[model samples]
Target chain A: MDSGKTTKEILKAKLAEGEPTPLYNPEALAKIKDNFAVWKETVVQEKDRKNWEVTPKTILGSDIPRSLLYTPIDNENLDYAKDLGFSGQEPFTRGLHANMYRGRTWTLRQLSAAGSPAEVNNRLKMLLERGATGTNLALDLATVQMFDSDEPESMGQVGTVGVPIDCVEDMEAIYKDIPIDQISASIVTHYPRNTSIIFPMYLVMAERRGIPWDKLPGSVQNDFIMESVVRSASEYIPPRDDFRVQCDNIEFIRKYVPRWNFITLNGYNLREWGTSGITEMAVAIANGVEILKDMGKRGYDPDWVGERLAFFWSPANDFFEEVARLRAVRRLWYRIMKYRFNCKNPRSMWSKCHVQTSGVSLMREEPMANVTRSAYHAMAAALGGAQSLHVDGYDEAFSIPSDVANLLALRTQQILEAETQITQVVDPLAGSFYVEALTNKIEALILDEIDEIEKMGGLVDVVDSGWLHNKASRYIQREQKMIEDGTIKIVARNYFRDPNLEMPEIWVKEYDPALAKAMMDKLARVRSQRNNEKADNTIKALIDACKKGGNVMAACVECARADVTVGEMRRAFVKAFGLWKTPIYA
Target chain B: MASKKKIRVLLAQFPLETHSRGIIAVAGMLRDAGMEVILMGNALPKQIVETAVQEYVDVIGISTYCGGELALGGDLMKAAEERGIKKRTSFLIGGIFPPKDIPKLKNIGFDGTFLSATKEEIVSCIQSAVAAKN
Candidate 1:
């Protein structure tokens, strides 16, 4: 009793009054009055100068409150293990890989293309020469997304929206000198039904070149759920048949190309639609889980399916918040796979995501500022440990990324890796008080969102009900109002003015009326040249497979061999499946 | 039955080839500002004449975004003339139709062309062009 008293006396003598430790706070309200006062001044400044009011914003990752004022007491119950897992562990609240960027740098993939595939191919070679590790393909909406170059729906549109890939010849032409075996490529299109057919063209090229199948190291944009949502809005394909296409592709990829990741659950598009980071994580997690479950029902091993399963997310302007969101996603995924899905494989839970800087944040005015925005977002993604990343060009808002802007975007990542030396440490912000607390908060929020989504009977229910669409629309509307009302200051539009700077020469693809005609002519020539009977038989077989509940990808492969264009295959399926009608909210 | 007064105009919207939503919206606004509007939901070469003849339109609006606007827009204008509506009508394009391409649109028989993202401003441009005699 005497020794205990002495020890207490010694500890008390050495300690300061109410120190509160790292994440704890025992400071009185009066003592912390300065922080509140600063916050109040900020609010007053915002309200008075900008005419904007800061609400208790309930964003995705941070659920405590949307308001800036977050007391330590708000997160008193946030668990270190149960709520926030350690970096590089299951429930990867911090990161996916153990070493993170210390072992490998984040991929700097800029969404790029122009004019013809042949023209774009030369540009891609230039990008590669200038130190791009991966090539990202942006398909023109007409040929790649809609699968038709000359349809009434596609008039005055080809190679203008994105890089136009009309046929197998175009795909082969784009990937000419670039070795697909060594580098990774990500195509930003949601037509798996189209991509599945288009993929074999590359395989055929590889076969001719003697490139082994195992050496092919690129990814197909095969996210069925993501496609279903976007196409649901666009009225592209029916939901039921969309799932059928997705599952069929999953089964096919599992059997044939073990190395190639099948689909990347595209939360980036959903995020672009205006959901918070937490909502993006939850919806994406639910999407991934639902797909895995569907694959399991189709007799696919979760381990095999999970191996090829990857994800795509968007990192916005919010720095630490975005980092926490990434961390929380990996952690929550680990838990769901282990506790919910009963997956035993350690690898099954790891989140492999390709993150892109949010394009929405890129403004048309003072567009050059977007370079800095992208660099910051890229830094957050790297710190959060993204395997691959695509930085939006400074001029992304007005036009499709110009070649000069793409070079700058690529250089942003290169500069971070080569000059910054920030990648030397794993989870560099690991034990920071603010980062830890935010990670815990983000994890809790994501789990809660996943729970809510699961109760809605998973991602399918959310899409079918137009819940995601409405949510996204609402989010967009709010952002639009904010921009219009000057609540969200978009530099030259709302806040600061650029008086002297001359508008740079906007790079635009000169109208190639011949290109559109050439595309139609190509499609017509292929139809006239290819064996019509064989093509008919192959397409008929694919339709039959869709009805008979057999693997449709095998039939799709045959369709590609028969020179079945993406439009014909998509049209045949749409004719058989009918189209998905979206709910009219107005 | 002498020729009765009827508003005749063309409408156009497209995803690619660089046509602006602002241009289409402006054209719609111009028609609402009391000119006849004949809208096309993105027609190709073969359908352009069919649309013009079917509507008996006085003017056609082609919105192009994908750099090939001049040639495609020019081709559509030619197709309209060949179909015997040449002297009776006019052609106008709006969107990223560059200033450099102004002469080309003129050479192609386009009555006038306006840049995208200026609806209220382009209203006067359209009216002035409409008021000018051949």
Candidate 2:
């Protein structure tokens, strides 16, 4: 059976047999261009005079044009096995699981957060009671920055944007009565150093309740690159050490919490912060490479780290482009994981993602219209084969979604899941003439952006040089100008101006006067009731371990159970490592 | 032609509000429209009002979102009044809010406010507010 031909040559010969006729014709495309030039002189010129300033182009966030028509003039080169394999197969451009939602529908991971543990707990319970398959919680600014609620810097910020957690008790109370083993719970935080502290609290709390570590399901949004790129840089320690703590969690979780997806590299923040779809995809990938490079230096296996990571992305208003973006990300992630990172595991190469519809696309005026926009983006996510999806509330542009709005947003997803036959098939849009072409275009743009960053010495160096921030800020400003110039028409702004624009009555969550008192009093009680001697000793040991450049998770777990506050852990960090200075560009 | 003294404006967002992109874009647009814009990045209300007094700017723009802290805007006016800059400077608020909140914001001494206003709307507001102050 041994042949003279090499395995590579054998594969080449097998693939060379009977290729389909090219699906495109250059002569036909050229003929269209010639006709388009004439139409531009006559029909388009007449239209341009009236609409030129309204929108510079009918384009997707990837900068792909919206032509008057699409007829696949150059899609002849699409190979099925090469470009897209079947769901759950090699080079998984379709879906991660073979069954997709057919096995189980996409998880409705509605994000619920507020000031106090009890308050957020109520919201989470409500979400689960109302049919949410998973729940995500956003920590307040104080907790995100590693501050205790009683700190002066945390004044008036306790439990504002997300839930507030000051001590182990707060974490316990946040999940009180909700069985952690049953429902998927995700804690959305920026810095991994914070995750280093917060995850220990979750693990210790789960352990105390008799739940096995592997049984606790969900992810921690512990990506630090986007924190530097889009979020306030002041919120994190410098990239190098922030990533150090990120790997610490990776090493610990691989050994202990094997079932938990420890990292959700969040490009949703960047996209919501104003970068386009291609940039978001590239930046998220670049962020992962940077983290893996750091982990490699520390001797963590690339495949082990890659397999455990997940992604969070936001698709904007472009329907087909959003669908194409989801497809392109899977293909791009596969190439990166296998070729660049040397990942052999098929699961390691799969890009499992949780998608959120863009909140920035929501309009404040005539807020009800946002419901329609959200439905379209949700349809795109379903058509794009998201593993899980969170549809934005119609009232998100103003405040956190009210009870009514939150319910309606969840209902939107339910209707799509139940009413439509979307989840019945994997990669529903695959093999389409327009969708396939757009997917290729997006994949090309992502590589181009990645190449540009690689030329700049990668993400960490570009951020160190302040280039990433400048690009994001400038793009957002330019987009604003476009909207103002009547080029990018926003609904109810430049496009639809309702004559009777009566502001609809919306239920606003009143700022609880007692919420701050409640948070501070809890922190005070924990500080007093804990074994002060053990707490102090544990904190000291944790800081010393960090200074010694050891994996601090074990010590962190020890300190967490001893009831050391987030403030103490953070204070120890700043004492050992000075604050990072963010590069400022005018 | 004498270089006219550019209309000076000061802007800031509430402390801990990382939604600074909106204010940053507004600051850039205002500067591009030929006004001298001073951006005080996320700061406390007192720090913002104090900067307005110290800088002697023509307008004080405060960005409030994430539940649109209406009370914080009122506190800002009170702080500005204590510093004796409330009457001298025009106060404005910008955020995503219901149209119903505009009158309340005005009642709290905000000469004007923007609920996702256009660049043209923002620039014109800055121009007219400065002209009125003069």
Candidate 3:
């Protein structure tokens, strides 16, 4: 009789035989312990006076207490093969690639978008010319909130946060001269519902340019977590329906846009929305697991969907913790894929991520210091084996980055790639005792949190029940209190508060009212000029798809070809799925 | 002697702007400061004013992280005036607007504008604005 078990499962069961051996010999460890005790009594005790207690100890975001020093004792049970595998191997704790940056550096992708599509196009061209290797398109608040430019709800907000794209025309205008096939573009559609509406426009634009869908190389942030947990908007679709749309988008993109990363499981916005790094990774991984299970139920192999799946993370100010977190999540993701999902493809197991510097860490006071902060965050991302990076601008604390600020951000990554010798080595901090121990600790903590979330009926139920929001709320308040009480020292914000210090004037990009009007006019033109009958039919089809549990992405692509606006397509989904009042406030 | 009434406040984010961390933190702070807070999620200026008028809140704090503070702030004031709560309700603006735009927000009938303000400072400012309104 066939047991019907996978090779990975069989091997995993076989490998869990007994307790692992210690890295160091017992005699050597005993000798070190004796020497350490002697040193602490003679040298350490003489210097510090009272005991070995260091006042006000530091702690990581996961509440891991830091010791004075970490030795082999801390990682005694860390088997290199099972735990920190070699780069490009099973359990790729070192890195996804063997050579890492030495083979090819991480993509210097600066997030740039603002004003109208044409204006944003200009900035995109300028950034590419100035050394940005990829395009990161951030949508405007109205677009992200799923409202047309002409809607009253979009007043004073069109093209304010990022570029506004209403229909295929706006999409074409944004990528007019830019070669869609040449460079990858990260369409920062932060929600699954919006991704279904907006990404199809990009696809249609590429088709108009005669670019095949298979040739498109980019990603859409098609994570429902953004809509449900991170971004608080006026309206929301129910979590269950949003998750359906997410899986639909993933299934469609995986089939057609073979090169495109269907979903960048977003933890950047989640962490920036006031959660710790552990929570961010746990939530994202939990979301990824739920997505895999859903897709599996849809008759798709986990490896097929997981190959193009990627992650987006925010590397914060905590240097080593961020580095260790990246390493830990990489290994943890590989473990989940290999053991839980029975994924055979190596690419499916790889936890490739794009990192953005933490926007919340930037302070408005002495804003120039934000440059240094972002640079450090960028460095941490690089050391942590990020596949791509977006160093946030100093003015991010205020408004969208001006041209100069954007250039400085680009230069930050360029400098690290060119000047710093950090990239020459793969997983530069791999063997460090402290980093390894922290990596082990963070991995365990994230897995535990993921377990807890699963116990609470998984990500969808947790989000729908507002448990995630409540957790975020508590962290938000605690972080604010810490900063306010000078516990979390932010320079110029709390610590060395200097009101009279001479500061360089940062040029904030002002919102042009004409830009909003122009967007509205263009949207009106698109509405009047397009085939309204075709648009209406496609929208109805979209509504049908949404209501009947059909592929919403296919309907969205048809709607895009028919010149349906983003807001209109979104309205179709809303009309079908109805609105869900987020359990944001208890 | 009757106890003093709690400082009733309505805290909201500008419509379409999704950054809610600051506003959420402020809601916690206001609640801790013994104020009754009616938190709204990304409401339009009209909705915010109508809610304020209906709830008869003492203070309205609008947090706008994205740009267009001048336009949104002006519209909020206009809505308050249209509802005839311009004088009775204290309007405050906070979050990541440029310092240079503080005067514009104030000129647009905002009772107070805060940029990078501490929680203590915000609570005190709200308290004083409510006191002056009374």
True contacts kept of each: 0.17, 0.31, 0.78
Q: Which ten residues in a row have the lowest lDDT in candidate 2 chain B?
A: B63-72
Docking quality (DockQ) for each candidate: 0.16, 0.37, 0.72
Interface RMSD of 2: 3.0
Model 2: residue B76 alpha-carbon error in angstroms: 4.0
Q: Per-residue lDDT for A217-266 in model 3, tens only?
A: 88889999999888978888899999999999999999999989989999
Q: Which lDDT tens digits does candidate 1 get at residues A1-586?
A: 1122221132234333433334334465445666766766776565454433243332222224444444544455444555445666766766777777776777667777766778879978987897777787777767555557766556555777666665566677888988888877766656566666666666666766778767787788776656665432234566667776877877776677667777888888767656778787777777777777788777766777787778898888778888777776776677666655557787888888989888767765677888998899899998888888888888766567777887798789889899998888877776565666677678767767776666676667777787876666556555544544566555665577566644444665554667778788888898899999998998888778877877777777777767777777776677666777654321
Q: Best candidate, lDDT-wise?
A: 3
User: Where's the lowest-lDDT run of ten residues in candidate 3 chain B?
Assistant: B1-10
Q: What overall lDDT, based on C-alpha atoms, would model 2 receive against the true structure?
A: 0.77
**Candidate 1, which segments miss by more than 4 Å at Cα?**
A1-72, A83-86, A125-131, A148-155, A208-212, A231-235, A498-504, A514-521, B1-134
Name the best candidate (by TM-score).
3
State model 1's lDDT: 0.67
Lowest-scoring 10 consecutive residues by lDDT in candidate 2 chain A? Answer: A51-60
Candidate 1 lDDT, B33-121, residue by residue in tens: 57666545444654766787888776677765455566567567667768887776667776554456678888887777755333445
For model 2, chain A alone compared with the true chain A gives a TM-score of 0.88
Model 2 spans > 4 angstroms off: A1-60, A66-72, A233-236, A545-547, A552-555, B1-3, B49-56, B67-71, B74-87, B97-109, B131-134
